[model samples]
Target: MARVDRGAADVITSDGHHLAQYAAPLRRATVDDPVALPCVGDWAALTRLPEGRYELDAILPRRTAFVRGGVGRDSRGGLSGDSRGQVLAANVDVVFVAEPALHGSDFADLGRVERLLALAWESGARPVVLITKSDLVGEHLAGLLDDVAAAAPGVDLHAVCSVTGEGVEVVRNHLGGSRTAVILGASGAGKSTLVNALAGEEVMETQQVRASDGRGRHTTVHRELIPLSGGGLVIDTPGIRRVGLYEMSRGVDLVFADIEELAEECRFSDCAHESEPGCAVLEALESGELPERRLESWRKLQREAAWMARRTDARLQSEETRKWKVIHKSMRGRGRP
Candidate 1:
């Protein structure tokens, strides 16, 4: 499927030659799990309804899926009570984490990049960090790149200027060979502009950011998969203001692999790394080997991932309990009859 809205979807034929817009509706079973519904990049089986409409019968097992917790927004601009995982894209091969090279006094939001990278790693896709608007930073570009690179170790990092076409080719190279990549970033990070650059045409609309605070208007409201002229596919999503983790302990560990490695040398197996004697992580922090900011970011993500895991477990247990209750109720009603 190239796009999904409500219960309908725009599906691309298996041969990749035809696109049927809003032609596929969800099968009853497919509606049980919201995250399992058709999403951009998902390969689905379609059934023809008697009413002459195509229904999304089933989705093929996804090689990778980009999911986040808390689908709705709360009053404080955080995730709402809805704890179900929301799948952004399915079967994605590359996750491009974009951030503006110049954001007020900061070159890029390293924390956001780290968070997105964790999600990308958890999605079973290769995560690449793209520092957009490199042209604006001038001589500071190298330093900015280094800072962001520090945040994303063992991940491909590129400082790209979509307007100037600088560093865009290298980023596009990963999308070759019929691979699918998804652009994830805050609004005004030049995701759409980057997509246009990679596509060699204005496939997506672009909007300028506000001058006062560098925030951008939401130009891409829906997630749509666009085929690149050079080959491969890209899913452009709306600017995400807040992205909550969804049962991502492995992802968090991968993101903080350096800390994980350091912790192995701790004297105790479960050292908290907080003033614990012989704690290599704390030692690295004190010795300037690990930045304090990075350590704090890792800790925050770990806590959040743990909390989300607990919530997911509770939700699943509750659902199972409800299922049994319904079954027992049905049996009781049958006996009475």
Candidate 2:
């Protein structure tokens, strides 16, 4: 599926044809489950109705999906207890995390990049950090890149400027030959501009960031998959304001692999790394091998991931309970009849 909306999706056929279809979930599919719904980069089975309208029958199994904790709103426009995992994109091979070099501060937000990297790693896709708007940083660009690189270990880092067309080819190289990528970032991070650059045309819209805050509006409202003329596909998502970690596995550990490695060398198996004797993590921190900020960020993300995992567990239990209650009620009704 190229794009999925309320009750329809834009689907691309095997013969390279595009068409919009009324895509609704099958009756057996759980509508509450985000994974059951159609998303960008999904391969779907469609059926033609009597009137010749195409209806989506089912979504094929996904190789990888990008999901995040999503909170639903109440009737009063406030957050409710409907916290579920929302699939951002499905069947993605590469996840491009875009962070502008000249944002609020002089450099990109390393914390945000790390958080996105953790989620990207969880998505089963190769995470690539794109430091957008490198032209504005001038000579400090190299230092800024190094900082981001230190934060995101084992991930490819590229300093790209959509305006000047710098470092775009490096990004484009990853998207050749049927590989699908998704661009993820906050507002005004130059994600849309980068998509346009990669597409080699003005396929996506662009907006100028504010002079004072350097933040752009949510230009791209929905996630749409665009097939590049140069072979490959890209999914462009909206500017995410709050990114909550969903059920995490080894993603957090992978993001903080350096810390994990140090913790392995700690004196105690269960060492908290807090003023412990022979703590390798603390030793690295003291010796300037590890930055204090990185350690703190790792700790913060760990706590968040743990909390979200518990919340997801509770939600699943509640859903299972509700399902049984309905089943019992139906049995009682059948007995009465």
Candidate 3:
């Protein structure tokens, strides 16, 4: 076990190799205790224990953070949700949006791919598209790569097969020491298989896809940060079925940059780009320069982001009002008047 000096916890290994270090000296509340907290890809100052043990003391500053909203139950016990930002990973350089091969000669789900790309861009990390399971169905790799390139302009796309070990080196070449990357996709996308192949061992568990439907069950339950033997680190996350847009306005703008750039020529400064005369975005769509699907995706994400912001703002306002009421009650009791 290699003990890393992260400053706080002593690293100990039962198998004589360092895999994981204890997070904190004592169990503490996640909400109340803030310093000893740990997030994926965080470099911590740890304390080395006797016999090669380590514990985390403090988390160093992060270069980037990928956050998502936490879901909670509502008052009626159905699904009341508030936006609690949970950091998924930090300091990630690249985010791999892996997708499975489409079945029955149908092309892959481009819209889902675009959503993941938007989230990746919003994560403050460079996005890379990975189309997995190339070995199955004899799908041409170039066509998938081309589709991805068209869907996500200015992003790297790779066609990789974990089972055949094809196109894996290209992914490894980009990773090195201190570089972190995250793998994201739905269940049965072969993310765990890809992770195992990249690690050169069975570090993650993989499940076989159903023969009839071509869908697989979720195998990974928790998110983990694992160091690769080749040098860099990788964060493997649970299969995400849906990823909602959360305050990702800049990312949506970046995704539809062509439309945004053309909108400057609109007659009104706040043109909706819908039925507005002299709207350059609409003109481009009419001229066949811009795909209607791309514009629709942009509009959908923009509206979703705006709705998320409104919900978050409403929650904050409620909290603020409650705080003021408490303060007023305290002042009334003090009799300062």
Candidate 4:
């Protein structure tokens, strides 16, 4: 469904037709499956219930899904101990990692962009670094773009001012040909404004950011897909608060591939990137060949991904043990009868 509101959803069909579908009940076992969840950009088979209403019969396998850890909770309503990956969007082709260029956050949020880029690369889709609110940047645009480009290697990066519509067309070109794009960023990053500009209308509500910190409120309450007039789809998501790693080792490798390759030239096989003898990474940093900031971002994400992997393994082990316990309990009950 394009817009999931309350218990109902606004479904869009193959030919751009719209239909209202009542929420479908999910099975207990399938409810916890991230792939089975009805997210924006999910392809599903529809069914006509006996009550003359439509329901999502099946959620087909997604080609590409963007998942993040820490969305699930423990029994006490706190964050879960294990890495519970919540799939944000499905069947996505491109991810727009938007960050605000205006305000003091332009260069300040490069680490955030790096973290999001790791997540985006792990989603099996392309990532585009979008610096929104470009007009507010003035002459610093070129410098800021250079910094962002260095942070995002082998990815498309652009500075787009949605209000003046500068560079918006270049952003839309990435969404052409019925491809699905997902807008991912923190609150007040001008995600909704860019969506409206791409749609050529005010398809989403936008609010001004706080003057003190330039942070925006949660204008988008949920993730919903909006079809663009120029073709393609975009799933607008609410501002993400926590972006803990989601078993994204491959993504981490890609984001830090430059460092990874550089490490191979070190003297020792197990050479850490620290102040070790003949460490290529450290040498590069000393010579200004590599930025210290980029290396720091790489190290942080690597550690986070490794920790999340251990947590994921523990969670799966617990789930397996619980499954066997339930199976044994059922067998005992049947034998007693």
TM per prediction: 0.93, 0.93, 0.83, 0.91
> Which pairs, if any, clash in model 4?
none
lDDT, candidate 4, equals 0.83
Model 1, which residues run further than 4 Å from truth? 14-27, 30-32, 49-53, 73-81
What is the number of backbone collisions in each predicted candidate, taken in the order shown?
Answer: 0, 0, 25, 0
List residue ranges in candidate 2 displaced over 4 A: 15-28, 74-77, 80-82, 103-106, 334-337
lDDT of 2 by residue, 1-337 (tens): 9877777787887666445554444634747786577789988888867886677888889999998887778899997434588899999999999998874354888899999999999999999999999998888989999899899999999999989999999999999899999999999998999999998899999999988767889989999999999988999999988888878898899999999999999999998888989999999999999999999999899888888888788989999999999999999989953
lDDT of 3 by residue, 198-222 (tens): 8999999989998888887899876
Candidate 4 residue lDDT tens string, 125-202: 999999988788788888999988888889999888899999999999999899999999999989999999999999
* Candidates' C-alpha lDDT: 0.87, 0.88, 0.75, 0.83
Better of 2 and 3 by TM-score: 2
lDDT of 1 by residue, 101-188 (tens): 7745677888999999999999999999988998888888889989988888899998899999999999999999899999999999
The superposed Cα distance between candidate 2 and the true structure at residue 21, in angstroms, equals 4.6
Residue 34 alpha-carbon offset, candidate 3, angstroms: 11
Give the 10-residue window scoring lowest on summed lDDT in candidate 4: 20-29
Query: In model 4, which regions exceed 4 Å deviation?
Result: 5-8, 14-25, 72-82
Q: In terms of lDDT, which candidate is strongest?
A: 2
Candidate 2: lDDT over CA atoms? 0.88
Give the range where candidate 1 is weakest over 10 consecutive residues by summed lDDT.
17-26
